[model samples]
Target chain A: MRNLTEEELRVVFEKLAKFIGKDIKALVEDSNENYCFRLQKDRVYYAREVVAAAATNIARHNLASLGICVGKFTHGGRFQVHITFVTYLARLAKYKVWLKPQSEMSFLYGNNVLKGGVARMTENTPKNQQVVVFNQSEIPLGFGVSARSSLEVQQASSTDLIVLNQADVGSYLRDEDHFVGCGL
Target chain B: MDGVEVDLGSLSCADVRPIFQEETKQELEERIRRSVEFLVHGLFTLPEQSSERKSQRELPEPFSVIPRAKPIPKEKPLTKWEQFAKIRGIRKRKRDKFAWDEGRAEFRPIHGYRSINDGSNQVILPHDPSLEPGESPFDLLKEGKRKRIASNRKNQERNKRSLSKNQLPTHALRADKRSSKSLERSAKIVSISNRSLGKHEEGKKSKQKLSSTKRSLKKSIIPNGVERERTFQAVNDVLKNF
Candidate 1:
């Protein structure tokens, strides 16, 4: 579980940063696992993917600050990749702009009521509602560059990602419909 | 008309009389059988139509529609099963008419009627719980996190669909007057983004500076100090110098 040399990790980060720069501010590879990279941003994104490889090809997984192992499934195949990331920024954006405001409309219909369990945070939400708050829960949406491609190194080809942020997502959502379910 | 001439010489009464009498007897028997069938099958019935026919014949000439009502044409008396069916049919038709009238009355447009969800004139904030009428449905909706999110998404989708309908090229929805301006504004913003990212490069470069200034202005407007520290410093410094 020795860390990859600074050079090796830098190459991977640079390659990945180019694809999802809007969502990922930076990423780090720690010395706790082989072939594992920690993706960093305002909030850690939950990385979920469908990956297929031979028993000898890969070893472990990690996402920035989250030590919890995300769920995984395997099929008898040589190559596959299905991934999902639940970012705190994304969750926060959803709560503030989409979910929290909806509570005011709860008395009207059966479907609008908020089941009491998961804590929520948002502006304009009433004081009585009791929401767990976070100061760094924001995602930059419209103001970023995004790209996905394969980068061929000397021995193996890895999928490269890059993202760049330029605009405030809050304003963009204001002009557009703010209430979207799931990750848009 | 001289009561239609009868050629008795060519037609023998011997053969004809027996045939007529036999037919009359058969018809009388059948009529009696039907009367018995109606009584035995069920009490409700058309009482002896033959008697009704006889009474009609006895009425003053002016009161009769047919002078010779073609003697009911020897119909076989209703079988017991048929008698029951006829009575049931009459009752069913009467019941149907009554039910139909009752149902139709409910749907009729009353002079000043209003519906609970009337979208007729303007946006009615759904009966607010804050109002005295009842705890608003919105409150029920607010109780569950999952339900609340689902409802908001549904509402947004409905609004989007309605907006699209209103902005249709030729036929706009007259009912969406309140939302038309806001929808148009947002539609323009969407068009700006969707404008093929490839068009008019020279314009984009010239407009780039304008956009950056707008971005800076937006950053300066953010209330959080951490977000706009540099802009706040510049503003404060200018204010202090003044």
Candidate 2:
């Protein structure tokens, strides 16, 4: 594993900031442990400093993975957040959308959340803003970008798209091969 | 009595101690006062030039007794021209500040303020055989001057960019914040508000999606083992709000 370059960190932070906003700072700087972001095979991993330092000793090719794989940098250098990072995003997300019981299955199936499925959402969530998707029980299922702001969502038709699916729990099964390759 | 050695140049006196074993403090003080008076008298005796009720005395250069406060300044690095001149064994000759202007028929400054070399002062231009039918030499001169100034400005800006690039990445990033902090904050807000967290929107050029606040995130990729403490401090700050 190696340190993320400035450009890579910027992309990662920008993606993370979309959901967590300023809480991205809390992820890097924690009171319990010295956490950091490392890049291994273009995969961004959030790990403790000691773990990252120790991982450096392992042969670059031999090392399968280090810490939690938050996301991976595409060949184009764009950072795509994986479902694995949903837990942290769920906790720290500034804007969140809750799905109804009937809509949870559709969201888990990797479908865009329809307006009818959105039971509630954080107030003042702007359109195209990244938001963590949660069930009515408050368990975060995934995260996506809002197709409409909270005010606009009310005006939108029931069939209109609310949250544009970016990543969901369904990816764990669908994209299992990719996750295994990343040692997630 | 032992002879007292006093150097007026350094304004220091040596051997001012009691010459006699029975000499009183008053006698020592009296001797010092006399030495100071002698120095003052010597200063007044210097050659003087009187003009308009003011007499200017030519005081002899005083020899310094103490070492310099700071070390001698280092020699400045030579420019490319200077280096080239050195290689060619070109001894610099001081040019006269004033030069005779043939056209003006008068002595003018060689540089700056109505200088002899200033082409703008010329009224009748030397006709060029290669000139276009309607092209004025004055306009050509002005254009050339403008191009020269523009190139110089471009080079200066390039030099500044390269200088900042050579600096440490962290320092360079910090340099951006040297501007007004509130202005930067508002600029960041505008960037974010442009298109949903500043993501490049459809039908919009990539150039339009400029996000400036991303730099505020953790700059360094590797943790320096102090993040935990920072987090603890952050937690404390949050708790303090309660």
Candidate 3:
């Protein structure tokens, strides 16, 4: 609800650059609370929340980017660090690993990936590297960390204990999963 | 044993048996008696009348291939208002079983009594693979191997030309730079050879300058984490203005 000044904007931008790992070309604030932070004219992140103090700390600490989080207007009442879909996509575009439909379902359900489900992975992907998980159509489904390097995944029969899932778009589609269906 | 009658000739055997065994009186009586019994049995067994046969004979023969009968005449039960409504309803009613909703860009009546399950809508389409970190399908790789088993003679000739160009000494490259045509020819030559030109040629060469120009023109081609490291140094340069 609060507006950020020029000085605060600079701090936010610096934090975003650290988080996004790219130079933010421009930052445009809309009439509403929604903020469009441009990476380029075409590529932009619509940040829903911005807190100058938190952003300053994020930049100072060099914390790994959590994309856009619901920023606290006041200092440290409660921080809602949410990974926005745009950031999800950015991660997916770069650090990607493909999952079979079955693996995709499992990953969406917040289960860790097992061996042999990865249809493809980025070359030179070292073991334990963070990866974006994608479905067969190549849509970025979520994010995870790889259990094995790309070469090991290929050479080794099982990527057992591979790709531990962090977040997935399936969360939006599924309920709390209070009751499971028999796929009836 | 005391009264055994051995002499049957003298005994009255003719009197014991019938005096006239083939007599006409006996034959006529036997024949008359058989005739009377037969007449009585025939009269009782025979049917009195054939009423079914007479009725069947009286009726006309049915047609072997009968034509379908005409429906009975009837008047329309609907009123004028009702008939008009019925005709008006036909336009929409005549529509295909599925009605498309342009607003949603999907079929209307999605939730229906008849339509129990819509798994297609339920299924999530994966993001386009091109959007992911991958080599473009259109990207012509430095392909050493042939796609097909059969060798292309034309390709081989192009390859040979490229090989001959590569054999040319590094200093010889400058001689071809004056004419744009040679540089264009070199690009074609390089592509066919399926190998990277030396690092010196990459810097000094003028052929396929578009490839280099594009590389320069594209500021942010790669997205995501890779972009982070590549652009990290540049970030400070850009941020210095602030």
Candidate 4:
């Protein structure tokens, strides 16, 4: 990873602020030293780390400074996602559409949500907007974009597309062509 | 009066004889005819109806008036099967009754009354479980059944049907009241213990709530704030980097 100048960092943060609906620079600290780069790294960054260096100042108190932690890496970090406890808790992630229980397994395997499978959705869930898909029990299945408006999805007769399957946690266990990381 | 009839063979009409004050020839003929008819009736029915004749003879009149006879209702005998059904408390249909005895192939009484549906042969569903006392019955929907819980009244109604008519409701109620008093006395001891147990449970519930809240707070939010001041300092120190 290469460090970024203040100009490029400002631009990235500007786009991120719109997506997150908040000023994220105020939420970060400069002394944070964890890696926060995308695949092609270019950045000074802050990241959530479950572990801390023991020689650091106030290292003993770092464990109690945050909320509950669960394993984010599995098989010695060879995989970035674990098999269990994958929950979507991002406050910024908004739009959602739920599928019936019978359609959940196929949906997690990167299949498009078939007709009559939509359980419910937020009113005016606009087309082409990023939406998180959940199961009947509200467990986050993946992130997708609305292929149809919320009204059309509920009222359409033909088996038209409703959501475009993007990334899912189930894709990690079973290799699929469209397997991206958990969008949450 | 004994009518005299002098009838010798070859008597001429010109030789008319009158016994009573100058009777006409026509009157003499009627007298003679009446005399003959009386004699013939006496000969034919005189002995055959001798008992009646004797009684009538005591009466001065010639004939007597007879009284009219009344017709009696015909009685039918019950078959052996009908007797057995009656012995088992089954009876013929009456007004408002709807039960049918399939074994006997006939409509039977419902609630101990005869049925009035004389022409209906349609099958009826068992309404014993579905109906309450004195409630009118109608066709129920095939779905959405409501099941009634068994209760003392239901049991008492069953017992009342099995009981003889001599057993009155007041006697049963008095007996039940006495038994209930005894049961309540016995239950008081157990209820005292249960009341104390409920208090103990409440005490434990409050203690559990306190522990659960503390654990939830520890897992959800920051339990230590050592980096809070330093993190804010670094955010404020962002301008120094320029």
RMSD of each: 36.9, 17.4, 43.6, 41.1
* Chain B TM (all candidates): 0.16, 0.48, 0.13, 0.15
Tens-digit lDDT string for candidate 3 (B1-242): 12221222221111122335566987756654554555444344545556755422222233334355998665434544455778888433443556666645667554443232332332343455554477532332213223421245444433333433333333333432234345455554553443454333443452433333323212422333443333333445546754
lDDT of 4 by residue, A1-184 (tens): 1222334344444433332324244335333543222111111223343322221223222322221121122223221222222242223445677889988888877788766677878787778866667888777887666898877776776478888886666866676432222221
The alpha-carbon root-mean-square deviation between model 2 and the true structure, to one decimal in Å, is: 17.4
lDDT of each model, Cα atoms only?
Answer: 0.30, 0.74, 0.46, 0.46
Higher-ranked by TM-score: 2 or 4: 2
Q: For model 2, name the residue pairs that clash.
A: none
lDDT for B1 in candidate 2 is 22
- The digit string of per-residue lDDT tens for model 1 on A67-133 reads 2111122233111111122232333221232223333223112122222211232333322221221
Question: Per-candidate TM vs. native?
Answer: 0.13, 0.45, 0.29, 0.29
* Per-residue alpha-carbon lDDT of candidate 4 for residues B1-242, written as tens digits (9 for 90 to 100): 35333222222112234477778889878866766665444444433435745533221233323355866654433444565787998877655546776666887765323433322333664466657776534333222122222344454443433332222333244333344334333333333345553345443232222112223322322312333443334333443342
Calculate the i-RMS of every candidate, to one decimal place. Answer: 18.7, 8.3, 12.4, 10.7
Worst 10 residues of 1 chain B by lDDT: B9-18
Sort order, TM-score high to low = 2, 4, 3, 1
- lDDT at position A65, candidate 3: 31
TM-score head-to-head 1 vs 2, winner? 2
Q: Supply every candidate's count of residue pairs whose N, Cα or C atoms clash at under 3 angstroms.
A: 49, 0, 2, 5
TM-score of structure candidate 3: 0.29
Model 2 regions more than 4 Å off: B1-242
> Can you list each candidate's DockQ?
0.01, 0.06, 0.02, 0.04
Q: Which segments of candidate 1 are over 4 A away from where they belong?
A: A1-25, A29-35, A38-66, A69-97, A103-184, B1-242
Error of 4 at B100 (Å): 99
Which of the numbered candidates is closest to the native, going by highest lDDT? 2
DockQ score for model 1, please? 0.01
Q: Could you give candidate 3's per-residue lDDT for residues A1-184 as a string of tens digits?
A: 1223333345444544432333254233213543332221112223433432233233322433322432222253222112334343454244578888877778877788777777877787878665677788867776767788877776676657778876666655564341122111
